[model samples]
Target: MNSKLIKELPDLVRNNVISQEVATTIEAYYQSQQANSPNRLFTVFGVLGSLLVGLGIILILAHNWDNFSRTVKTGFAFLPLIIGQLVVAFSILKHKSKTWKEASGTFLFFTIGSSIALVSQIYNIPGDLSAYVLTWVLLSAPLIYLLKSNVLAILHLIFITFYAYEIGYGHYYSNETPWLYLVLLGIAIPHYIQLLKHRTNDNITSLFNWLYPLSVTIVLGTFVKDLSELGFLMYVLLFSVFYNLGKMPFFDTQKLRKNGYLIFGSLGIVVLMLIMSFDSFWYIEELVFFAQESYISILLFFVNGVILGLAYYKKWLQSFNVFQYVFILLSLLYLGGLNLPVLGTVIINILILALGITTIKIGADKVHFGILNYGLFIITALVVCRFFDTNMSFVIRGLLFVGVGLSFFLTNYIMLKKQSSKAKTL
Candidate 1:
């Protein structure tokens, strides 16, 4: 990763026909995108069709009541329900249609299923909303695989998205959101797998970008019935999204950006504010504070760590902004004594000093590590650790800072020479 070689990474990534994992992701993206153009067209028609049919049914119900008894009305209400289930079953069975036609029929069958469920409820049919929603999502699930329809997959995603939104945010914050997340994954995952196999579908990526957050948002919101947990979780999430973005090789900026990192990452920021507000957690309030086993947060931490390692493995220093900084905070809270009072403070000071040295050395290797964000991040962490943990003397802190600064300078001097020798080999 010399200066000249570092500059060529992105172009080489895009144009070199190596077609490795990079090609799978890239190919998946473009394939999904091509599928997306027609997907949009079919989607509009499907929604319009659902609405029109619903409207027409409503008009018939209003006027036809005079011509029908309760039994007749009930029979009619169940018509779409019965017909929809059969059509979906038929679509699954019909293995010879054009992909678009198979997808279109499945889409309509789902819409009709929803229409029946809605009508059934209005007519006082006995079923829970979750049950109905799950049924619809489940029934549509097979069509996604059966038809190889990205649109079918996305609709299933939206169905789960709205269901989760209802459970997590609506007046009823039921336990349904989790189940819905699983269901969405049920659909989005195959599309994800297809993107892996075919390596040319853009719609799959679009749907992935669209559904992941929708599901994650609902799930994260569930983590906090209170503001405190939600707040801490936010910063953790920011690390996840940023780390995810930063893990992309210098060449995958477009693909990474297309994945909606910022939108999800912004929410992570909002959550960070929430997490930071709980200054009490950083201190010793053993009895008053109840620590939950934040599986999600912990999972996020490990994920961020992997991202940092990938960036390092790829020599991606200039693009190092995501979850890497998360390590500083994580290092601070290392149940391994990094977060202990006197111990934690001293450890952070030392870690930052080491980080500054590492970044400068790495930067020397690349020559265009830009203004070294990783090094700047280390400095910022040192400042922030000191700001929040005021148990130390200012003089001691100042001396440590000055010491690390000198180390940074000398490290770079040695690193530059090492990198120069390395580059001579190239």
Candidate 2:
């Protein structure tokens, strides 16, 4: 509610601009609206306070650990868990506010982990860090939905990502697959869906948007056992899926900064294209597509294809992003590169140039300065790559840099003028 507007209501009524009844009604309505809005700060503080208190208890207990007997240590291990459970139970039964539920749920989540760790330490239980984390994550997964806690949901994602890295890429367990991470991720999807449906503009939803793709991107490498060269192609397909997903009406309607899928997908494709533009990337001694060890990559490629096909069926092409079609081009290029590496390199350079020009056009049409500069950066990056790879003279390279610099200045100047004119008209 606007405090100034509220203060003016009486003045307006005194001046006969509004009736007394009207001012009263307006004040009451705003008061009701203010009361109904969620108190985000309170929720944040409550959750933070719970975390600090939980840590404080752990520290105090740790200080006197050597002095305590086994019985007392065992009781202390269970104490935080019991207290947390009581808090959660109360929050559920009493139908407490979101702050209460979130704070209690967060406290309970840490307590669960603490209790496990304490009991393990107290009884000399044997387990690796990965197993301990996995157990903690599995136990806390229920709290995300049970308490309707977004914080817990985000924490769950982080923990699962860590677990994937530990199981998939850890020194002791490099050969093992982190397949359980996928199932755990699937469990958290419902809550994310609910957030999108009911709280579309929420900060938590934005966090999920960023973290979800990032988590996938980080864990994707863990699935690559052999045919490491094919990993590049796998990432291309994955990013295409991300780009297409971002093009959907749900994400497309949101602000660009909030749509991590679009940003990651676009940037991923561009970076890969730039890397492959080099002749060295296309040169291969052995190209194996159908090896038994490459099954995961093949499966992911097929799945990504299906997803892209579905996106196309749903009219994703109407948006006409160049990166959306790069996956197809790159797929073809990958096969062709095996025989004619130079041809593949040339095609990639052409594709990147085309992508940059298309981006520049789109930015101009929309009068978006950021998009315009991004396109310029793309061209600039390509030129830089060429400078290193080619035998071009320093003078030629410097001229190219100068030309790119001029383009950047001119494009930005034109955009600013357009914005100024548009603003004046408004």
Candidate 3:
């Protein structure tokens, strides 16, 4: 419903372009459409306002903290929580709009944590920061589904990631593994699934697309207790999983920018390959296989194999990029490197070079500027790696750089000329 069109309806009627009755109907129809549209700004501001107000209340209470009696402090601690709960209850019982549910739910979420912290402080309760965060996360997890709030769901993910870091990395001497992080992540999956099924194109759904993989990427390192060398293998497998998941029908249709899994997976493999190409990386003193401490990495390897098997069964391999299947080659190279380090180094360097050329070919076939530039970047990066790692003369290294630069210019120019020719013919 264009406002300009609505305004011109009367003029159209007066000019005999339409009857008065028709003009009135058109105006009414547009007015109804405008009314039915969701107010995105209002929802955003409402959530922000609720968040700021909650923080403000805490700040205000903190300012006059020492002046208040113990009983007064106790009352103040629960006041915000009680108010937040009531608001959330009203929003739920009345079946309020999305804005109301989100605003109230966000306000209540912070209040629960603030109240918990205040009570612990006032009563001299004993607990570590990790325990406090776990409590806050658990209490607020239900709010995500109860109010159907995307904000709460995102917050839950952040808190869980924080909790994982606190337990796994923050406590150096503690033997606690962040295994609970996986369980907490699993609890949030149904909500994400619902979003995938019903709100596939939503902005929140896109946010989840980025966060889910990033969270796992960050947390996967926590599982490495010993045999740290195997960590690299674990990461490669994880990225492979992400890449294949992104190739599924639902994710494949999305724009490249929105497909975080594909982006992360491809970039991860390329970076790992580049690192492993160095001759120094293959010089291992001791090689351990199937160690008890390396179970997480082993399990991940099997999981990646299963995923690859499924991808093959589904015939996805035909459309996959070279990097998608490069993990297998790298795995074998790692095993062979245990005995023949120099050979492994040579093969990896050759593999990277071949990968760059293949990528360039794919880019030429697709006529995509981004893909073409990415392929060029891979070659450029490989050249840069050799510049430092090899004992080549300075003049030769400079010539290599110049050659890569020339290729970039010529490749892009040819691509643009081809595109122009097609445009003109069309």
lDDT of 1 by residue, 283-343 (tens): 4323212433245555666776677667678887664442346444543454444124465
Candidate 2 residue-pair clash tally: 0
Candidate 3: worst 10 consecutive residues by lDDT?
A: 284-293
Model 2: lDDT to the true structure: 0.88
lDDT of 2 by residue, 138-198 (tens): 9999898899889999999999999999887886547777889899999999999999999
Stretches of candidate 3 above 4 Å error? 1-37, 285-287, 290-293
- The best-first sequence of candidates by lDDT reads 2, 3, 1
Residue ranges of candidate 2 with Cα displaced over 4 Å: 1-31, 291-293, 423-426
Model 3 TM-score, all chains together: 0.89
Error of 3 at 183 (Å): 0.4
Q: Record all residue pairs in model 2 with backbone atoms less than 3 Å apart, i.e. clashing.
A: none
Q: Best candidate, lDDT-wise?
A: 2
* Candidate 3: Cα lDDT at 89: 97
Candidate 2, residue 282: the lDDT equals: 80
